[model samples]
Target: MPAVRLSDVAQDAGVSLATASRVLNGSTRVPGKAVAEKVEASALKLGYVPNAQAQALARSRSGLIGLVVHDIVDPYFATIAREVQQQVFASQSQVLFTQTDREIDTEIRALRSLIAQQVDALVLVGSHRYGNDSDAALTALLEGFARNGGRVVGMGQSLGVGRTIVPDNAAAAHELATALIVGGHRRFAVVQGIAGIPSAGDRTGGFIAALTEAGIEPELSIEVGLTRDGGHVLAQQIQEHLAAAPDDPVGESLPLCVFAPADVMALGALGELRRLGIDVPGQVAVAGFGGVPDADDANPTLTTIALPLHEMARQAVDWVLEQPDEGSAIGPEGSEGGAAHEAADTSPEGSAEETPSEVHVRGDVLLRESTALAASD
Candidate 1:
């Protein structure tokens, strides 16, 4: 038997080859319901399989996008990837997800692989710092993609080329830190994510800014990684720090509060605190960012700033699908003013000028049993 082609399917359906192509491509602008049904029925009867590469060549689009992420196990990135997949599906495009494991070399390799595959666009979920020596290499890679008329969007932050879709980390962190301050917390401990990552820096800066606004000197503690284990280790270190402090003559317990940059870390902190017989929100308060679903179901519901992962994913796809403009060169910078720019550019037209599109869909600070007023001396 000969392999069935688009012409064969169209002839069998009594329609033009273009009609058969449009139907298989999932175009919504096809003529009418009857024509669409006929094309679909013919396709089914012939058991036709469209050659993706040939279709791409004809349309001048690969119909595929690359999604590069830091870690697949992390709930935050996992949820965002899921939403991205759905959005790509709606656009009649496929997604190729690649994890870099926070390594620059891995990220570069992933980008190169995506380019070789001829993806229509590149979506970088989370990437680490590129070295000075490797800067040219990275730039050339992105420039080549752009020069070829491909789109690239960042889910976290990118140095150059394309747009970024991210939450209001600084504002969200400020809000959560202010909550601790309002609760009368003075002595603070923080567990940071990867040292140089933009998201980590934004979160840490927000925490410091909140403490500075209150005229309280913040005690800084940084963990190497951003995982749950990182938070657990930091929690133990905080306990050790407290133990080393000289006992006050008045028996006054120091106001202790732990600010984890991510909810996974916060959960780890809670676990360590409980293991040490320390009551959460009783002896100390714990707060984190990126409200993972499991946080709400924890032994004590976590107090977290909910990042709009799904909405961010959806907006990222939209940005990639839209035509790039001169303003597309602007990438996310870890500063209050930079955040403002990102928000303005990504937002829908005629909406609040100050309201950033990335931050628009953010979830509220959910207060649960995990936090409470600081204990008195």
Candidate 2:
């Protein structure tokens, strides 16, 4: 189908090309009021739509926000992305989404593409792989974006590049650990995600730290992909491990608890457990992170950490739309602050310049049937 161009509207309204452009593009130099009304009516009648890119270039604002995530299929990322889309839409702006599959280089390419497209701001949602050359390269790229007047916001890992909404992964995992400990199960196993992702490390590390602090060493630690298939594979591994001591009941003769740290993985693990004729809580209690909407839909429900995904995404957009105060950039500290910004103060040295800020969001622990207290015999 052919698009309705400005010329089409002009001809239909018996107006000049320049007049049609002015009326449709919000140009200050519009024709007479009567002519403008006629052109608008023509556009409406013909369903003419202005070119957003051309309009953005003329106004020096694209009205487009860029969003990058790991996997859109994952509920964690989906929830946040939906909120971002809603918030951006509310502001008369739109979102450009990209998925990197947890690859740093792929993420970098996505950001670069968004930058080339002249997006107003960049919002990154997913894990951060820090302490590497890629991290330095990413920092350089973000710094360049900032220099070009583009804003950057992070969700899980800050990368120390922009305003970051960090979730207290470790603290939440610690709470989960505490809950499991109080439930009277000691021997433990972990089905962890890809090795270098900081968010993954933070969750597993926090749980392990808490167990160590309690003088309990975990029995098994299995590394796998950050997918449901990974969880299923981990389930197979568990079945093999338990088969060696078939006579001993899990959480009793062997006394075991499993932590997957991600709801999808835990749910997959649950399916595998049922396939192997294992009873949850009765055989091995399980816990996960990310209180996805369907957590309660699992056969026994899931015990996990519920993150404020909508709030975080909404704030990401809000921060992007917010005007930086004179001198300092916006931080996530005060009423107008968040994380850190560029050292170059936009305001005078003596004046109150807003610094860049970091907004750390905490997760709530939901204890459900999967990780419920063991039944006393």
Point to the candidate with the largest lDDT: 2
TM-score per prediction, in order, is 0.79, 0.82
Report residue 43 deviation for candidate 1 (angstroms): 2.0
How many clashes show up per model?
1, 20
What are the per-residue Cα lDDT tens digits for candidate 2 across 211-309? 999888888889887778877988888887777865544335544678987888888888888888888867777788988876779978988999887
- Per residue, candidate 1 scores C-alpha lDDT tens digits across 133-210 of 665777667655654556656766554665556567788788888877676567777765565477877888888898
Q: Against the hidden true structure, what lDDT does model 2 obtain?
A: 0.77
For each candidate in turn, give its C-alpha RMSD to the true structure in angstroms: 7.6, 5.4
- Give the range where candidate 1 is weakest over 10 consecutive residues by summed lDDT: 335-344
Largest TM-score belongs to which candidate? 2
